[model samples]
Target: MKKDIFIPKVENVYIAVVNEYNEIYNSQDWNAYIINNKDVDLEMVLIVTSGYNEGKITSTFRKKLERLPAKNYAKIELMQEELFALNNTFKVSFFEGNTMYDKTFLFRKNTINLKALQPIPLMDVKGVLVK
Candidate 1:
């Protein structure tokens, strides 16, 4: 019975960390975003994020969205520079049509930096993408 379960693969959905100048604060800030590159919309989207290291752990953050349109993206949270030293993780769950999909994206310790940035899908700026 365990082998009879059919789990669909999640495709084109990603979590990205972007560093951009904050016009209001007049400083650069690191922000997390959820990208939906699929042709269909995602409903009841949920994301839980946290950072951890050998002996340090950050607070868990939970965010939810009613819907995420296709080929679009939405900002999830602001990431403090201090969190960069630890391994950051994002747990995503959402519904496509009548099926549910889940995926985990992670950024290893000390990896969220400008040097690791690359062009992100559906976004004009470059940023680090979680694999």
Candidate 2:
């Protein structure tokens, strides 16, 4: 039965953290984004995000989108600088056609930093991308 079960592999979807300038605050802010690079649209998209470390744990956040168009992106949330010291995890689940796909993207503790910034797919800014 296990051999007969089929689970599709998730591709072209990613979670990225970007450091963007906040004109109102006059400071750089860390933000999370969901990028959908697939050619097909995703339906009932859900994302659960949280951060944790040795003795510290941040609150879990749940976000839902009715649909995410192909080759597009959306902002997930604003991350505080303090969360950088903890392991940030983003659990994403969505349906493509009649198939459901799930994936978890993690940014290990202290891994989200300026030095790690790189060009992100489907976005104009550079940031840390976890595939």
lDDT of each: 0.95, 0.95
Candidate 1: give its CA RMSD in angstroms. Answer: 0.9
Query: Compared with the true structure, what per-residue lDDT tens digits does model 2 show for residues 33-116?
Result: 999999999999999999998899899999999999999999999999899999999999999999999999999999999999
Give TM-scores for every candidate, taking all chains together and pairing residue i with residue i. 0.96, 0.95
C-alpha root-mean-square deviation, each candidate: 0.9, 1.1
Model 1 per-residue lDDT tens digits across residues 90-130: 99999999999999899998999989999999999999997
Q: Quote the lDDT for 47 in model 1.
A: 98
Backbone clashes, candidate 1: 0
